[model samples]
Target: MTKPPPTTRPVITPSRVVAGVCLVLPFVAMLWVGSYARVTPALLGIPFFYWYQMAWVIVSAGLTSTAYLLVRREERARKGDGR
Candidate 1:
């Protein structure tokens, strides 16, 4: 019985760390920004605090996407997909 080839997997990598950080940043930001203080602004008759959270919706999406992409790329590289 012949043993199968061992898989080339990374125990840790830079991309993985970056991706993980990216994923956590928005949540931290949301918590800090939301409960830290209060702001009053009249943008289209909307309050500053309200708009701040709303704006983070987009920012969070972007950060999550970036994290996803970085992790994916690292995974691909680890798998040796023609890198």
Candidate 2:
């Protein structure tokens, strides 16, 4: 009897692309320091540099969660489990 071929490669889909973008956005925003490296436009006396990073802490959480959910949903669908 012949053995079945192994499924070694991952499939790339639109949902996966969106999830990847969602996950990468936070890193890009934080790493590009020049964009947020400033002291003007203070918020409640807080410097822009400080406030921008702090705000990203919250935004990053939301974006990461979204990416996780998207991947999880795609996996579940692939497994034929609607729930």
Quote each prediction's TM-score.
0.72, 0.88
Q: Which candidate is the best by lDDT?
A: 2
The TM-score between candidate 1 and the true structure equals 0.72
* Deviation (Å) of 27 in candidate 2: 0.9
Q: Write the per-residue lDDT of candidate 2 for residues 1-83, one digit (tens) a residue.
A: 99998666888999899999998999999999999999999999999999999999999899889989999989989889642
Total clashes in model 2, counting residue pairs 3 or more apart in sequence or in different chains:
0
Candidate 1 residue pairs in clash (backbone atoms < 3 Å): none
In model 1, what lDDT does residue 36 have? 33
Clashes of each: 0, 0
Report the C-alpha displacement of residue 78, candidate 1, in angstroms: 0.9
Model 1, which residues run further than 4 Å from truth? 1-10, 33-36, 81-83
**Listing every candidate in turn, what is its Cα RMSD in Å to the true structure after a full C-alpha superposition?**
3.2, 2.6
In candidate 2 the C-alpha lDDT for residue 7 amounts to 68
Query: In model 2, what are the clashing residue pairs, if there are any?
Result: none
